[model samples]
Target: MKQFNQFAARPSAMSRALRKAFVYMTLAGTPALLSTAAYAQAVANDESTSATGVGAGDAALPTVTVNAAGESGQHLQTQSANGALGSRSVLDTPFSITSVTADDLADKQILKLGDVFSNDASVSDNSGGYSAWASYITIRGLPADWQNSFRIDGKPFLGYGITLPYDHFERIDLLKGSSGFMYGFGTPGGLVNYISKKPTDTPVRSVSVGYTSGNIWSEHVDLGGRFGNDQMFGYRLNATHDQGETFNEGYLRRNSVSLALDARLTRDLTWDFQSIWQNSNSDDQTPSIYTANYTGATLPSVISGGNRTLVGPGQHLNTNFQLYQTGLTYRINPDWKANLSYSHSSARRNRNEQTIYLKNAAGDYDNYRSDYLEAHTYDQWQAMVEGNARTGFLEHQLVFGASWQKQVNDYTVNSIYQLSGTGNIYAQNTNAYYSNTALRTYHAGEITQQALFASDTLKFSERWSVLAGLRYNQFEQNAFGIGGNRTSTYSKNATTPTVALMFKPEPNTTVYTSYVESLEQGGTPSLGQDNYGQQLKPLTSKQYEVGAKTSQQGWSATAALFRIERAAEYTLGNALVQDGQSIYQGLELGGAYRPAPQWQLGASLMLLDATYKKGSTFTGNRVAGAPKNMATAQIAYLVPQVAGLKLMADAKYTGNTMLRAANDIELSSYTLFNLGASYTTRLGKYDTTFRAAVNNLLDKRYWQYQYENYIKPGDPRTFSVSAKLDF
Candidate 1:
C-alpha cells in the first residue's frame, strides 16, 4: 500500500471519513446549493435610444425592454412579418420569427438572459444548482448543444460554459422552429441570435453606476458619435463592470467592451465593423447530493444528509471571450443589396477545482482532477447577394449566399491523488493527462455551407395577400479531432414550401396563419465509416402557427398558438440516443399597451405541453427538467411631465415540473416578484438616475430544477438600491 505520510502511520479513522465524503459527493448532491441572484442590459442610439444611467448602492435593478419584434425591426416601417422581409417570404422560410426590440428593452427592467427568454414558454433555464453559474437553456425541452449556436451582433461568441453578460446586448431574437435553412446547425426548437449595440451617427455620451444585494456593484458607459468631415462614419461604444458574491462564498465579476463603426461607401453601399471583448469569472456548477422523497410527499428544504461546503474548494476560475467581425452591405440598385460578413473568436477558459481546507465544511478532500480548461477558436465567413424587384409581371426577392466555418479546441488538465484530511502537502509531480490528446484531440474542422433562396408576394387583390418561396442549401464539413484526422463530406438537398393568407378586417388589425418546413442534415456516410466517425442523416421538423396582432390607440398585442413536431429527439445516453421522439405544442402571447403616454404595460406568457413517445429509459414519462408553464409580465410608467421619473414592477412565474425518470420525484412550482423605481435628471450634458428595487420579494422557498438524486432550494427575499450617472 502507498503511504501518504512517510513520517507517520496511516490513520484508519481519517481514511474512513474521507471515503465517506467521496461517496457522498458522487452519490448525488444534497440540498446544499448556493443562492441564485434574482437576475443578472444596451447600446445604440437613434431617436429611439433611452440610456438608464448607472448607480451604486445595495439596490438590484435591470436595464430592460420588453418588445416582441426585437431591436432589428424597430426602425423598420412594416409591422407584419412578410412586409418586413420584403419579397423574401418563401414557402419554407420562417416569417413568424420574433424579436425583443431595444425600445421595449428600455422600458422593461429585465437583467439576466433568463429574464429575456422568459417570454417564450418554450424557453426554460435548468441551471439546477449544480452549475448555477451556467443555465442549461432548454427550448421545448431540447438541450442547447451542437444544434444551438450563439452570436453577438451576428458574430459567433462560443465559450466553454454558458455564462453571459446581458448588459452588453441590444436585444435578443428568438427564431421559432427549425432554422437550419438560414441559421445552420441548431436544434429543431429554435435559436437565440443576439444583436450587438451599433454606433449612431448622432452624438451622445452617458454613464450609469448601480449595485445589488450581497454588495454587488456595477458601472456602464455608452458613447456614440458621427465620424469624418461629412459625418458619414459613425461610432458607438459601450463598457460595463460588475462585482458581487453569489449564494455562498463564491464571487462574480464581469466586464465587456463593444464597439461599432459604420461607413457609407457610396449612396447605396454601407459598411459596418463591430468588435467585442468580454471576460468573466464564474462557477460551472455547485450542486448538492440529494435523495428524493420516495413517497412523492413534500420534502424538507434543507437536506438532512449530504455534503455542505463552498464550491471548487479554494480554486479560482477565469474565462475570456473575444471576437472581431465586419460586415459589408451594398445596394446594387434601389431594390437590391449585397451582404458579406466574416467573424472570428479566440475563446479561452481556465478553471481550478479541488479541496481547500480540513476543518471547513464546504468541500471534499479529494485530489481528483475535475477542473477543466480549454481553448476553442472558430472562424466563419459568409456572403450573400440578394435583390428585390417589383414589376408588372410579379414582385419577387432572390438571395444567394455561401459560408465557410472552422472550429478548433484544445483541452489540458492534471490528475493527482492527495491526503484526505490534511490541507497541505497532498500530491506532487505526477503524470499529467492532457484532455486534448486523451479525448477529442486538438483538431480543426472546415464546413462549407451554400444556399439559394427565392420568394414572391402576389397581391391578387387589396383584401387578400398571398406569399410563396423556395430555398436550397448544400453543406459539407471536414473534421479532424484528437482520435486523428478525418474528413467527412456529404451532400444534402431540401426544398421548403410556404403559404400565408392574411385578412385585414380593419386598418389596425391583421390576422394571419402560416405553415413552414425546415430541413437538417443528419448523417455523413463518409465520417461514420469508422467507429469515431459519424455518418449523419438529416433531421427535419414542421411548424404551424396562427397568430393575430393588432396595433390600435398606442397599444399592440399579438398572440400565437403553435404546434411543432420533429421525427426524433436525442436523449441522454452513451450514443446520443435517437430512439425517443417528441412534439412540442405551446401558445405565445406578447403585448404592449400605452394606457397613458407615460404608463406602459407589456406581458409575455407561454404555456406548453411537451410529450415524448416510447423510448429506452424515458418511455411514456415526462422528460426531465421540462417545465409545463412559464410567464413574465411588466408594467412601467415614465412621468412625461417630470423629465426622467420612472416606476416599474415585474412578475414572473414558472410552474411545477418533474425532476427525474420516475416522474415521482419533482420540484413544486414557484413565483418571484421584482419592483424598482428610477428618477432621472440632467446636469448640463451629464445624465443621472437614482434607482431602488427588490428581488424575490416573497422569499418563497422552492426548488429550481433538480435531478432525482438531489434537492436544492431557490433564493430568499433580498433588497437592493442603486444610482446611475451618464455624460
Candidate 2:
C-alpha cells in the first residue's frame, strides 16, 4: 500500500470490505433518491427542510425559529401552522445564513459543537486535540479572529471560546460576512448564533442517551408544556451531560453540562432564564508546529507527548466557565414589541505545566513557566423596542429599533513568566525564597461602547428596496498603569451608515450589496516604559461585500465577493510592550452548494495582500500566521434507506498558506477525510441508532494551524462508535 502520513495507519480488511459494500449500495439508491428530488422540485423553495422529516404541509410540528442573528433574522420559516413567529431567517435574504435544523442534527448523529462545522466549508477549527476549549473559527481565510461576532438568541458575547454544547440548542444559524451592525463590537469574520430551545404552547416529553468510542457518554432530556385554554402560561426545561476520553493518553478526558428554563406568563409578557456550568480538564498534549517527532511528519503532535517537556508530572489544564441569563419581552401590541435582557459569564482557567524545552544557548531545554492565565466575569444588558407595519410608498414592510449593550472584563491576567520545564530539574523553584519574581507584567483597561441607532427598510418598488441604517457611537478605553493604579483613557466618536438595495424577482432568490465597518482595541504597551498607555489606540477596519443567494426546496446556495481594509493595527509586543503599526487588506470569494436533498458540497477562497506601507511596523514583512492563499472544500453524501442501515462519507481539503507573511514562513496545506454510518431500528416504542465515525481518514501530517504555532499541534485520526436511544 502507498504510504499516507506520519499518523496514518493502513485500512483494516474489515474497513475496506465495508467501504466496498457501501459504495455499491449507495449507487443502487441513487436513482430512487433522484426521483424523490424530482417530486421535491415543487417545494424546493422550502427544501432545506428535507432532512428534518417535515414537508411543506407538516402543520402538526411545533414552532422552532430564531430571529436574533444573520439576515435570517429577517426571514421567518418554521413548521408551525400559523407561520413562523419572530424575525425572518437569513436564508431568505441576499446575505448568506446556513441553518442546521434539529432533525438534520439527529439524523447525522452530531454530538458536539465541533461536528457542526463539517457542514460549513467556510469555517476552520485548529485546536484539535490539545484543548476542546481552544476552538477557533476562520472565514474567507481571514485570521480566524479578523472580525467575527457571536450571538446567542440575539444576545451578543465577545472574546474567544468554544461551543458549549449542541444539546441545548434548537438550531445553529451561521450568518456569513460582517455582522457587527447588529452584534455590536465584533470581528469581521461573519457570525454564529446559537438559538436555544424555548417554551412551547403544547406539552412534550423526550429524553436521549448517547455513547461513543473513546469512553464518551451523553444524556439529555427536555420537558415542556402549557397551561390554560388560551395557553397564556407555558414553561420549558432542558438539561444535558457529556463526558469522554480520546485515543491518545496525554490528550484525553473531557466533559460539559448545563440547564435552561423558559416561562410565558401571559400573551404580552414572557421571560427566559438559563444557567450553565461546565469544566474541561486535559493534559494539553500540545503538538509540534515547525517540527515533529521520530517520524518525518511536520504536523504538530496530535496529543501533547514526550517525557522531556513534562510541564511537570501530571501536568494539565483546567477550565471552567459558567453563565446566567434572564430576559423579558412585552408584545405591547400585535405590531410592536420590546425586550430587555441581561447575560453574564464567569470564566476561570489555569494551566499547570511540567515540560522541558530548549530555553537558552547552553543547549539547555528546561522546565519553564509560560503563563496566560485568564479569570474574567463579563456581563451585557440591552433593552430595545421595534415595530413593523405596511404603508404607502411601500408595499413591503419596515422595522426600526434602538438598544444599549455593555460588557466589562474583570481580573484580567495579562502577564508572562519563565519557569522549569520539569519537576525533576536542578532549577527547582525556590518556593523557599520565591526567586525570579522579576517577570514582566501589565494590565489592560476596560473597553466600552455606547451607541444610538436606527434603521428602515423601504420598498421603493416590487423589484427594489432600500435598507438604510445609521449608528452614532462613543468609544473609550483605559490602560491601567502597571504596579500602580495610574490609568490613561482614550476616547473617540464614530459614525457608521449602511445602505443597501435588495432585488428579489422570485420567492426563493435574493441578491444584495452592502458595506460595514468595525473597530477594536489594540495590544500591550512597551516594557520598562511606565506609561506606554497614552500611545496605544483603537484599530479601525472597513469592509465591502456583494453577495447573491438562492434557496429552494431542500437546496440552498450562496456566492459572495468581499474586500476588507485595516488602516491601523498593533504588532510585536512582549510583556506590556509596543512593537509595530501596520495596514492589512484582503479579497474573498466563497460559496456553499447543496444540490441534493441528502448530499452537499462547499468551499471558500481568500486571497490577501497586506503590508505596513510606512514606518517599518513589520516593515516590508508579511504578517505571521496570516496565510496568503487559503481555501477548504468538502462533500457529504448519505446512504439511502436500506431498512435499518444508513451510511455517510465526506472529504475536506485545506490549501497551503503562510503562517506569517514575513520570511514567507509557510504552514503547508493539507487535507483530511471523514466517513460514518449508522443503523436505526425500533425496539418496541423506543427508537435507537448505532453509529461509527472516523475523522481525518487519511491522517496526513503538517505544521501548526497558526503563525503563533505556540507549541500546539493539530488533531490526529480517531475512530468513534456511538449508540443513542430516544424514548
Candidate 3:
C-alpha cells in the first residue's frame, strides 16, 4: 500500500486528478447563469462585504450584503475569506480573526501597515514606526515573517524591505495562529491578507487633498464604473501623489497607481485583471541603534521628537514596486464554482543607511554606513474548486485546490558596508554618507513551494458541525555565494492538518475548539554573527485553541483561549542556533457596543505568557520583544444637534517588553492617545467631508525596541487635516 501511494503521487497522476476535478465541477454547475433573471445578472457584483462588514466588497470570492450603521466603527460582523476553506462568517470560524475596511482606515488617516492594528490588543507594532527599515508586526507574542506571512488576493507576496500601497486595497484581514493547512508554509505567528478594490456596480468618483505635519501634502483620485451595451465591462482606477517633509526632519516623495478591470465573457464566466505601480524617494531617515551593545548596562536616554535623527544627515532610500494579477472565475451554479489565477510581484530597493552603536547612557554612540541595491520577485499560480453537497442525512461544504510559488532574491555583488564615522546621539552630524560604485548583481537566494489542500465542513444538525482540513507541501530553499557557488540547500516535504468542532447554542452565537499544525522556514544568521549566512533546518509548530463569538443588533463580542508551541532560535557563543521550544499561552477579548444611537464604544484586551521552555543558554527566559499585557479602548460620538459631525478618542497601551534572551534589560511600557473629528455635508452638487486629527497628543517621549537588538524612538506628536469631495 505504501508503494502504491508513492506511485500514485507522481506528477502525471496528479495532473490527471486535477483535470478530472475541474471537469467534474464544470459538469455539476446549475447552469442558472444563462437565465435572464435579475438575481443572475446581479451575481457578478454581490461578492462578500468588506471586513468592516459594510461598504467596500471583496473581489476574490462570492460575497453577501451586510447592513451597517453609517460610520459607527463597528467591525467583525461579516464573512471573511478563510484560505482553502472559502469564505465564512466570522462568528462561525474557529480561529481568531479581524478585518478592517478602507472606510475605517480613511477615517483614522492610517497609511502605514504597522499601525493597521493599533487598536487590537492581540497585535503589536514591531517596525518601531514609519521610520523603520520595513513594516512588521507581532501577533499573539510571535513575530510574523515577511516572506510568508503576507498575501495579496490569496497570492503570496515578498515584502522584505518595502511597504504595500494601502490605497490599493479595499479591506485587510488578519488570521491568527498556525495556518499551514490553509495557506501552505508560513510563520506560526499568523497571516495577513490584502483584498484589492474592484470595479463597483454603481459609478463612483472621488478626489481628496490632505496635509500632515512638517508641510507635507497629499492628493488622491479614485474613479470606478461599468460600461458597454450589456454592462459586461467594469473598471476601477486610483492615483495618488505625496510630497512633504516628515516629522523627523526628513523629506519624502511618493507616487502610486492601480487599475482593475473585469470582463464577462459569458453569462457564467468572468475574467479579472489588476496591476499596481509605485515609486518612492526619501532622505534623512531616523537613526536606529544596536541595543545589544548595551546588554547588561543602563539604557540610553530617550531621544524625543525630531532630535532622534542625529546622524541621518546624508542617508537616503529609493524603492520601486510592481504587481500584476489575472484570473478566471466560472460560477457553474449557485452551489458550485471554479477559479484559476496567476500573479507576479516585484520590488527593487536602493538605499544608503546609517546605523548607530550605543556607547554609554549619556547618548554617546558610534555610527556606520552602508549602501546596497537589492531586488526580489515572487510568482504564483493557483487553482481551486468549491461546492456544497448532501449525502443521506449529512451535508458538506468542500474546498479543494493546488498552488505553486517561486521567489528569487538578488543583490549587488560589491555592496558597501563599513564604519563611516563616529558620533553621539545627542549631537548632529553634517556628513554621514558613504558612496558605492555599482557592480554586477548576483543571485542571493531562491525559494520554491508547491501545495495541495482539501477541506470539508460537515453539518450533523442545525446547531452542530465539524471542519477538517489537510495540506501537503513540498518546499525548497537555496542560497548562493557571490561566485555563483551554491552555499546551502534545504528541501523537505510535510503534511499539515487542522480539525475543529463547533456548536451553536443560540442564534448568532457559536462556540468551538480547534487544533492545527504548521511548517515554517528555518532561521539564517545575521551579518555580525559567527556563522553568518548559515541556514538551519525547517521548524514546526502546533496550536490549540477554544473560542466563542456572538453578534447582535447593537453589540458584538469575541473571546479566545489559545496555546502555541514552536521551535526557537537564538545566538549562542556568537553563533545562531535552533534549540528548545517557545511556548505562548494567551487570552484575548474584543467587543464593540452601542448603548445609544449617538454613542459607540469598543475595547479589547490580551494577556500572554511567552517563554523558552528548555535550552542551555536561555531556558525559562521570557521571549524578547514579547509583552505580557496589552489593551485598547475607543469612543466615538455623533452630535445630535449638528447635522453631520462626529468626535472620536482612542487609546492604546503596550506592556513592558524584554530586550534580550537573558532578560537583563527591559523597555518600559507606554500608552498613546489620539483625537479626531469629521464633518460631512453637501455643497452645491458635490458631497464633501472635512477631517482633522492629532496623534500622540501628549508628545510622549519613549524608545521602541524589537527582537534582539533593534531600537528607535517612537513617533512624536503630529497634526493632519484632509478634505474629500464626491461628485
lDDT of each: 0.53, 0.51, 0.77
lDDT of 1 by residue, 479-506 (tens): 5555655755555666655556666566
Candidate 2 structure quality by residue, lDDT tens digits, 576-636: 2234434445554445454554455555555655454444445676644455555555554
lDDT of 2 at 530: 43
- List the candidates' TM-scores in order: 0.74, 0.74, 0.89
The positional error of residue 340 in candidate 2, measured at the CA in angstroms, is 1.9
Which scores greater on lDDT, model 1 or model 3?
Answer: 3
lDDT tens digits, residues 439-481, model 3? Answer: 4578988889999999999999999999999999999999999
Cα error of candidate 3 at position 121, Å: 0.5
Q: What is the lDDT of residue 340 in candidate 2?
A: 79
Estimate candidate 2's alpha-carbon lDDT, on a 0 to 1 scale.
0.51
